[model samples]
Target chain A: AQSVSQHNHHVILSEAASLELGCNYSYGGTVNLFWYVQYPGQHLQLLLKYFSGDPLVKGIKGFEAEFIKSKFSFNLRKPSVQWSDTAEYFCAVANSGYSTLTFGKGTMLLVSP
Target chain B: DVKVTQSSRYLVKRTGEKVFLECVQDMDHENMFWYRQDPGLGLRLIYFSYDVKMKEKGDIPEGYSVSREKKERFSLILESASTNQTSMYLCASSLFVRTGRFGQPQHFGDGTRLSIL
Candidate 1:
């Protein structure tokens, strides 16, 4: 069984502020990581994913995430965030040879204009 | 773009009633998933179907069952709805890659917010 942990429960930021959300997973085997964002009154959309190879992956809307294997972490980062970036971010992890993904408690990010 | 459409955006039902949530995908994806989203819990997988007439129990499947009679339709059924089952239910679909772990970037539906009173 695998579990995902999102360090922050809620985050508030001003427009153009830098954003970083910590995510860690507990799994010993090969794992796939993903970041999904859910905007208000919208469906969950894939922000980015890490399958293998390069650790840093870029996603839509200038969002990026780094997969640190040693730390079992995949953190989402953005140099400058806008009001539109306000959404609930979820970190999900799926182990190799499995068909299910485990999601964290999610972090609610509110960006003030 | 792939489109996963859930039948109802908001549903209200009473306890002990049978509930069914419908989902349809236009991409003809081989994999379909049903999940429940709560306030703190991001999303918990309740069921998954890889192919027609093939279903698998996910992390939390004690009270939920899934049906996949066709390639594009997946239904989540609650035998006896309970108050705890009141949450936002999401449907997702993705192509099945033989070489991949599960699937890439699953396309999600707008979700159905069910309230069991």
Candidate 2:
């Protein structure tokens, strides 16, 4: 069984503040990672994903994440956040051989204008 | 871009009623999934179908059922609706293309906010 954990339950940041949301997954074998973001009253959209490649992967909306294999972590990062960046983010993991993805609880981020 | 569409954006049903939620994907995706989203709980997969008429139980499949009669449509059924089942239901689809080390990602619908009173 695979599971994901997001350390930050909620986060607040001012405009132009650097943002980093911690995500870690528990899976012994090779796994795929994904980050999804849902805006208020909108559908969940893919922020980015990592299957196999350069540990660091870039995503839409100026977001990026690094897959640290040793630490079992894939943390999302942005150099600076805008008020429009406020949204709920979820981290998900799927085993390489499986299509089912297990998602973490989620992290809510608020960017102050 | 792929378009996954849920039949309803919002629904209200009484407890014990048999509820049906429909989902359709415009793209000819090989895989479709059903998930429930709750506050602080993220999204939990209830069922997934890899092909037409094929279904697989996900992390949480109890108290719920699913039907994939056609390749483009998947339905989630609540045999006996309960208040605990009230949550946002999402439908997603993905291509089952295993191109070597590459993997296919999923595209989601707007979601149905179902309420079981």
Candidate 3:
């Protein structure tokens, strides 16, 4: 059974502050990683994904994630976050070639201006 | 735009009632999935269908069943709705890749918030 863990349940930051959300998974085999965001009153949307090749993957809205296989971690980061970046972020994992995704408990981010 | 449309945005039902949640996708995706989202539980998959008559149980499928009679529509059924089953349900769809080497992100609907009393 594969599971994803997000260390942060809630995070509060001022505008223009840097952001990093920790995500770790329990899987020994090859895996595909993803970060999804849910804005208030909106459905979940893909933020970024890591399949192969580059460990650092850049996604929409100035979001990026790094796949660190050794640590079994894929952490999302932003150099500076805006008030509009506040949302619920989820980390997900899937086995190679499998479409079923295991998602972690989401992290709620509140950016204050 | 890829569109996944759920039949209802909010529903209220009673215990022991049979409930049906409908989902339709216009992207012609090959995979459709139903998930229940709770505050602390995130999103747990209930059922998925890869093809028009092929369905698979997901993480939490004990109290639910699925129907995919058509390519674009996938339905989730709760035979006897319980008070504990009240939660937000989301429908998603994605393209089926033969190789499965690359990851395909699922597109989601606005979600149906069901309340069982």
Candidate 4:
């Protein structure tokens, strides 16, 4: 079965710290990747997505993700963290020709001011 | 802006009671989905509908049923609510794309936090 894995369950960092959240998918076939963030008391919003294109995808709020097919990983990154960036991040994968997304266990990031 | 609206922000029910959770999408999307968000579980899909009167079971649909009577409405039914069912339920909608292509990203609603006593 296809699955997504987020290695970090919880992370804490200070303001301006670099961020990297690991994500890996098990499917070997073509896939679409997505990163979603949910703020406190807010709904989930798309951070970025990877289709067939440049491996580096940039998203809102200075967030980006790189899809490395050989490693089967799509990891999210940010150069500087803000207090407002404290939220839960989820990595999802959908097989080509499918509409359903399989999500990994989210990582909760707390940016300390 | 695409808007997906869940009927209730919070709900409390008794065990064995039948429960109904309603979702409406203003985007006229072709796909609507129901998912439960739990701690450590991220999001588990319960049911999804591709068109009116068409529904498909998702990864975790054993205890849930779905109804899509209209294009903009998708309802999830809990035949017998249980205490273990207490969790946040999210509704989302997205446009369908052709095979081998990436579909439109899903838009989510402010989830309904359902608690069973």
Candidate 5:
């Protein structure tokens, strides 16, 4: 079984501040990684995903994540965050041949204007 | 846009009563999933249906069951509701792709916030 962990439980940032949310997974085998965001009063939506490719993957809203296989990490990064970027972020991992996703305790981001 | 619609946005059920949460997807997706979201817990998969009549138990499925009589619909059933079951239920649909980026994103419904009294 694969387990994901988001170290930051809550993060507060001012508008235009750079953001980085750390995510780590405990899985030795080949795995698929995903970053999902849940805006206020909205359901979970995929921010980005990494299957097998270059380590760095860019997602919507100018968000990007790097998959570091050696560190067992896939951290999400954004150079500048807007107030609308405030949301709950979750990291998920799914092993090959397994369609079900295992998510970590989400990190709540509050961006102040 | 692919739409996944849940039956209700808010529901109140009494303990020991049978409760059903319904989900319908417009896209012809082969996979449908039921998950419960709680504070700090993120989303826990309750049940998932790959095809019609083919249901699979997820991480936490001891007290939950799912029905998929049709490919476009999946229903979550709580045989006897409990206070612990009070949480936000979400339904999502996805296509079968190895890379997981073949089809559109996993569309989600607004969600059903169920309160067991």
Candidate 6:
């Protein structure tokens, strides 16, 4: 079955530190990928999405994710973390004809001030 | 701005009781979905509707049913609530098209944290 996997369950980083969250999926065909973030007491918000075209996609709040088809990976990264960046991040994949997404376990990113 | 609204922010109910969770989207989106967000489990889709009166079972739709009588509203129903069903429920909506913007990015509600005792 098609599924998404987020390798990091929780990560802690000091302010200004570079951050990377790993995500991988098991699917044989073309797919759409997405990254969503949920801050404390807030709803899930889209960070970035990759449907087609270039493998590198940039999203809101200076976050970006690169889709590597060979590795079945779509990893999220940020050059420098801020205290406000602390939140839970999720990686999701969608089947070609499906509107619903299959999400990974999610990574809780804690950016210490 | 597009908005998805869930009826309740938090709810508590007794086991075996019938429960209704309502979601409304103002964007006139073609697709509406219900998902449960649990710690360590991410978001698992429960049900989704593509059009009025049409519904499809998602990955984990065993304990839930959905209603989409109107274009803007989607309701998730639990025939009999169970403790194992306690989790945060989220509502989302997206538009459907073909080509360039084939699919609208999904917009999510704040979510309803349901606790069954």
Leading candidate by lDDT: 4
Q: Which pairs of residues clash in candidate 5, taking residues 3 or more apart in a chain or in different chains? A: none
Model 2: interface root-mean-square deviation in Å: 2.4
lDDT of 1 by residue, B48-73 (tens): 99899999988899888889999999
The most accurate candidate by TM-score is 4
Candidate rank order under DockQ? 4, 1, 3, 2, 6, 5
User: Taking the candidates in order, what DockQ does each have?
Assistant: 0.67, 0.55, 0.65, 0.71, 0.43, 0.54
Query: Candidates' TM-scores?
Result: 0.97, 0.96, 0.97, 0.98, 0.95, 0.96
To one decimal, what is the Cα RMSD in angstroms of model 5 from the true structure?
A: 2.1
lDDT of each: 0.92, 0.92, 0.94, 0.95, 0.90, 0.92
Error of 5 at B50 (Å): 0.8
Interface RMSD of 1: 1.6
Off by over 4 Å in 6: B98-104
Q: Tens digit of lDDT per residue, candidate 3, span B1-117?
A: 999999999999999999999999999999999999999899999999899999999999999999999999999999999999999999999888888543478899999999999
Residue B103 lDDT in model 6?
Answer: 40
Better of 5 and 6 by DockQ: 6
Candidate 6 to truth, TM:
0.96
TM-score of chain A of each: 0.98, 0.98, 0.98, 0.98, 0.97, 0.98
Off by over 4 Å in 2: B98-103
Candidate 5's residue-wise lDDT over A1-113, tens digit each? 78899999999999999999999999867788889999999988899998788999999999999999999999999999999999999988877776677889999999999
Residue-wise lDDT of candidate 2 within A1-113, one digit each (tens)?
78899999999999999999999998867888899999999988999999888999999999999999999999999999999999999998877677677899999999999
Per-residue lDDT of candidate 3, residues A1-113 (tens digit): 89999999999999999999999999868998899999998999999998789999999999999999999999999999999999999999988767788899999999999
Report the error of model 5 at residue B98, Å.
6.8
True contacts kept of each: 0.62, 0.46, 0.57, 0.62, 0.38, 0.46
All candidates in order of TM-score, best leading: 4, 3, 1, 2, 6, 5
Error of 3 at A42 (Å): 0.5
Clashing residue pairs, backbone N/CA/C < 3 A, model 6: none
